[model samples]
Target: MSDAPVRTLLLWCPDWPVLAAEIVDGVPATGPVAVLHANRVVACSERARAEGVRRGLRKREAQGRCPQLTVVDYDPGRDARAFEPVVAAVEELVAGVEVVRPGACALTARGPSRYFGGEEAAAERIVEHVAQACVVESQVGIADGVFAAGLAARTGRIVPPGETPEFLAGLPVEALGRPALADLLRRLGVRSLGDFAALPAGDVLARFGFDGALAHRLAAGRDHRPLAVRQPPADLTVTAEYDEPIDRVDAAAFAARALAEQLHDRLAGHGLACTRLGIEAVTAHGQELHRVWRHDGLLTAAAIADRVRWQLDGWLTGSSRRGGGGPARPTSGIIRLRLVPDGVIAQAGLQAGLWGETGEERERAHRALSRVQGILGPEAVLTAVLGGGRSPADEVRLVPWGDERLPARPGPPPLPVARDTTAAGGGEVADGRAAGRRRGGGSASSGAAGAGRGGAAPPWPGRLPPPAPAVVLPSPLAATVHDADGEPVVVSARLAVSAAPARLTVGTAPPTEIVGWTGPWPVDERWWAPAEARRRARFQVSLADGAALLLAVEAGRWLVEAIYD
Candidate 1:
């Protein structure tokens, strides 16, 4: 029930993204290197930083500043793979190790401080152990809370007991990691954590929402350890045993993907995602090897699989650990693979979006689209919505992205009962000459009802029936529909057809024979306005090549409106 952050020790590897690039990709760690993501600098090596390249700089600007910079794309998998060895190394020296992210980890300091004689001694031992065991350099800090400890680790500082607030007070609001909130705080003259923390807690929650309130608590040194508060499900472990041992890296990767997917499926069934993963492998000689991988975000299936592959690659190749304190290399091929979730949480903040994509994926899309809008104009990006109209183009209206998706017209008008278009010997005619989603279809399954106007949806008159086309062209392509007598088929003002369509020619393509035909379903809209008025007859025709098309004839000109799959 305690609301205080436990006395914690944190280990941080500076510029771990760059270091990971080095460990996993063979990029030189001591060079002027920078990791670029979304055309922005995610992290820079010390040398690159010294060369005027910093995080968040545009990739182009960073290159301009450091001409010789080695650019690398940011890969979360590579970072986790490289850091897994470090987490395993730390666990050997301390219990209750929590991987805050790929590059940093934390553990309660009370026991370790006492066991090692003091807090500073425990920090020293952890730093030394990691360096010796994994050949990775890290800094350590001891503080009353994980939040403060993480900040302290940047400078290898130790905040005395009960003095965390003072230590965090002078830090900038940007340290909260909410860029927009920090910007607003700075504009409102709350530039530092101390000033932001002085606001009323209730007001912070009401204005900034839940995440902001959590940041406020961290600013006031009330950091709560999340991993310590709950127990993950124990039955989530997934394992795979192969008849043949996996000695090759490719074989190990193949096995890893299967186990990773199984593990993810089990966690998904519980509506949970893992933050910390335990991977255990058994060799033919009965020797067991295990490693832990952690991330700040939920580990996706691909990430879990990548870590498993990296760990197995290390074991089979005798690169288990650099120093003597790590696990010995396996003496034979791996016979069994196991994945255990050490830290699991509800899959909140990452729910699926409208398109069945994760929130993170949607966010990335939004950011990219927003960036494009910023460069071009907002109207450059548009989304389509279905509306009430007789024609496919009229039923769809394009609106600027992010705007309310309201249809331009009202709900469709009363529709006629659908009729089968299949005619015997009519040459493979469409089974049904209907319109979009079963004309007057029950509200869409995704948006269901109320997708039209707010209230009792308006009606679309002369609307076509169901069985929508697979593709609707933005602009109707010019085409010719003819009868067997080699005469052009035409629809008169009285809604009469001169002949049944027997051939169709689209664009510059040669005319193809039409086997079946339906509809002269006529529509006369906007008759009051001469310029906007439209009088057209629509048809569904099947061709000899086994293709179906939606055709419309207006003013003696035939147009291909859409095609059915």
Candidate 2:
């Protein structure tokens, strides 16, 4: 094999992600539209760009730029599904196409150019054919290597033989597609590929390391990485046959998830990760439906399942496709499903976190939860979310598991702490006229802003300090607090206690002696609404048996509110 760079032809699709949304999801592409991932814009349409929308802008900023923008989540599967027909069209014109991503593909220019008379002729022919066959516009560029060709395709330019370095020199370093590297280089005043290419190769290797060295080689038009992708092993395929055809989308989704997991597990056993997958389904009437979905990154089990579900949805509902799978509806319900790993590579850059962010144990737990959800409905599992509130019940909200855990109400800003001089924190309450007075200061806010999405630490005034109660009573247990005289301890209208609490009693439990006590810390809520107003004096007390309880007096009735662990 020649060591020189191979002449490569790259076909590019502009705004392919936005177009894919329209094709697969039926979101209109003509209007201002943006695709976002993790709240950042990944791609946008021309109309959105006209309105000042740009990649990397936050969703809110993007929407602000174009109020009428149709926002869609980034779906790699949709891009792949929609681009499949375009690949098929190109395959019809030439042999051996390597998908660089959902939006672009590459092939050797030698064969196509020689067969079509010249590079220019081959490029024009491919573009025209793709447009005619797939009804999608595309551009073609011929250059010394895949990287150069990919950049060239942006403007439909062909870099002359041995001139790729000159062609790439003026382009910005961002064209290398390494954001961190580009940012670092820009900080170092190396703004263009030419500047980076001029750096000493040894120094580049030493400073930026192996990946950086590879990027350096590309900047200098030395992308010798061959187009010799390995074919996935046949044993990596997984299949399932059902006696009862899956007619409903939910049933199909459940089946898809199982099959996807099997396929992923098989691939994992081989120490591999799939970048592209082929989904095959057989209908009850013997109709066979096959489609390939591509992803820019390794496909996780959930991602594979999602693609399978989407494909099955399209087939079952006869969704129209501009290309690829077309609008062909299966004649009957699907009775069998199969997953083929079309493209895979040695697993890299993925391992359990050093601090246990992810591991086999976590994966097992996730799978178990997902299975439970499938059987019991998505809402079956619940998780507690902690937010701003005065009491335990008010602070906690139960949400369906896996949903974002955000506080229902933003917490108030942290208040300055003022310690009481007479008591443990607040002066001990006693029956009879209080001997000491305690004014509780603002409890320190755990998060100044109550753990808002932005991580602001605004404090909640008078928020209880932590060492939170281990168990908050579902319903406050009826209780009584008494003094040394065995009389009910009363809290006056002015928060004055009848006497120091000496004993505590809960429903059916004998009186227990109070070892220590603090507070007639008053809580008044909804003062503005008479119908909803509530007043309570709360106390934290330790019992003779070494137990602690949170007690409150409301409407002259004592209740055990919570127990400390």
Candidate 3:
């Protein structure tokens, strides 16, 4: 709310997730690697990027594109813990360092700029300091506000005083960091920050609400909120003293969850959310460990607990050597754990619906899923998402339940509904068939068929029409399609069936009479790869039991690929 914009400098480390994982897990930096959250790429190394891997791609797609790519599960706590040393190094050069997240931090530029001769010099000094201390590549940028400064850091530019608006104007609206809003703006012909900034403020507020107004202010190079920095109340810290020394990661995790909930409850009572947290632990040997985590957005209870666990893992399992060697396990067990709410912001109260059900069920479901994740591993509970692909199997993606669900990309042309072979011209199949096909391809019962690798790439010219099967076999079941005389039925290269109107036998089952059958649809997949090439013809056959089956012929053999239940 201050009339004068605050001059801020932001330092950013590129590919922080990959860097953190490599540092903690000893992964080779030169190797192709990616960090995935909810089965979508969150970050990838340069080698992986060169191989066509990018953020937002599903895990299977990334692997398919780069066979050598190593995948690491996303751990925000690891990212934050790894980044702590970098923040400390920067703090040594400049005071009031405000971490934006694991990979980035911002601070008021006035003091550092004056001391180092200029904004650019201060930035260079901080970057150099971080590189020396953490051995990670970093960039620095200075602008009128945190939003503009963060954007500037991405390009390592310094915006002159009062010129932040002009600098922001040319950038794409995506700089706002709100994907949905940016996408909607692009569709509305508001392609750049300038275009968005030109919209009437009231209209933006009416259309997009509080989040939109915040983005609008940022796009215009104005601070969304006043730069009022306040210290968290001393009593807000949550501490747990263990009677028995706890050395294992699981034990620390158990303690972290309870403490995180306690901290969350206290903050909620005051209508507040933590933006920055400090984690502290004391070992039985009297050695102390401390780390700070910052978030650009509010931190929920789960997020706080995750950070605590990560910090404890680093402290307990990390190497004792401070001279840039491999991490060593701790010498003693942790005796105490504490969480400090270093920074907090007002959280608006939720408005209840007329029925008073305002998201209670969702919260309960989230808690239940979190509990399940705790009981099992993070990957045990998953949620399926739809994404771009040709086959019903390819279009579905699975991510851990509590993680952010990657937005589904545009898939191949919609599939055709299954119709009875008796119906004239094949009426559209039931909607349930489409949903079933999507779910069935990867459901638990289907085994690895729905494991995210069966989808055909887009623009598949010879793809079969949908009314996709309700149940897809993970692997085709060998079967025999026989003509009336009991001779084998074959499909020609021209896709003509040598003989139809026959009997079907699956895996030694009794022969069943075929009622009606459709044309064999030919598919030539991966023709470019000789060893992996597949040329097949598929048919939809109606049987005597009032069931439909999808049959595929490959290498002169018939197989049962799926069934319509």
Estimate candidate 3's RMSD in Å: 12.7
lDDT of 2 by residue, 13-68 (tens): 99999999988988888899999999999999989999999999999999888899
Clashing pairs in 3: 1-226, 319-327, 319-328, 394-455, 417-429, 418-429, 418-467, 442-450
Lowest-sum lDDT 10-residue window in model 3: 434-443
Q: What TM-score, computed on C-alpha atoms, does each candidate reach? A: 0.51, 0.52, 0.47
Per-residue lDDT over 264-327 for candidate 1, one digit per residue giving the tens place of the 0 to 100 score: 9999999999977888988898988776654445788887787677667666654433453234
Screening candidate 1 with a backbone cut-off below 3 angstroms (N, C-alpha, C), the clashing residue pairs are 411-458, 411-459, 412-459, 412-460, 413-459, 413-460, 435-465, 438-466, 439-466
Better of 1 and 2 by lDDT: 2
Q: What is the per-residue lDDT of model 3 for residues 378-487, given as tens digits with 9 covering 90 to 100? A: 46588777665434465567887645567466555454444443332133223333121111112122221122323553444444455556776778899998888899
State the local distance difference test value for candidate 3. Answer: 0.75
Which run of 10 residues does model 2 get worst, by summed lDDT? 442-451
Q: Kindly state the number of residue pairs that clash in model 2.
A: 17
